[model samples]
Target: MQNEKDIVIKELNAFLQGQYMGIRAYEHLIAKLEDPEIKKEFQSMQQDHRLHAAMVSERIQTLGGMPVNNEGLTGKIQGFISQMMMPESTENIIKMAIKGEDLYGIQLSEEIVKGDLDPESKNMVESIIDTDRRHLDYLKNLVH
Candidate 1:
């Protein structure tokens, strides 16, 4: 059974992994999509995820946990899975990314609200979640 500290570490790692996963999705979409404007937009979002990943990594280290590098095996699998179907249109890619961002935002928001994180960590996470919300809103606006 995981204690409070263990749960915190686990959630931190999961958030880190999700950021990596998101970055990979952006990179893949940028490469696969033919539209220049859409690709550029996704590139910007990828940079945001990189920043979030670094912050999460720092928090993991502060908690005396080894941050998983390269986004874990699940991240790798997800990258491969996205590659398998390869969306044909940039619009489709944006829709898929918005869906991912929505899910990611919901997951982290719910976890943070559970009140498991320390005050400082919770504040940091809330900031990151805010960024995700911005990304999702931007993607939706871009597509519509």
Candidate 2:
């Protein structure tokens, strides 16, 4: 059987990866946005994602695991084009990101429960899910 340390390490790595993904998504959105207020919010969200990644990385270190480098490429193309022209693609991209986040949250939660993860690790994942939900609502409000 895997040790508790291993389980926590795995979960922390997963959470860190998720945070990295969020940071990339928000960075893309901010680059595409023109409105000052919306851009500010996106920037703030980006900072939050950085914090989340740091926290998860710390936890992973405590659990004796090497944090995995992110390999995200979801928003690169759309973000670059939107950066040049403030198009109406932000809403769709944000919506798709939210959907992806929700699906990821569900899967992570299930994994936490089923795997040998600790309670603290599970709680951290849930907290990240909550934050993602808030971000989704904020983006949806902007769209509508």
lDDT of 1 by residue, 41-94 (tens): 788889999998899899889888888777689779877987897788878888
Lowest summed lDDT window (length 10), candidate 1: 104-113
Q: What stretches of model 2 exceed 4 Å from their correct place?
A: 72-88, 104-114
Candidate 2, residue 16: the lDDT equals 68
Task: Report how far residue 83 has shifted in candidate 1, in Å.
Answer: 1.4
Model 1 ranges with Cα > 4 A deviation: 1-3, 112-115
Per-residue lDDT of model 2, residues 1-144, tens digit only: 878788678766766666776677566666666678877877887787787788777767767788876723543454355456444565665665555456553455455546666777667766866676777677678768
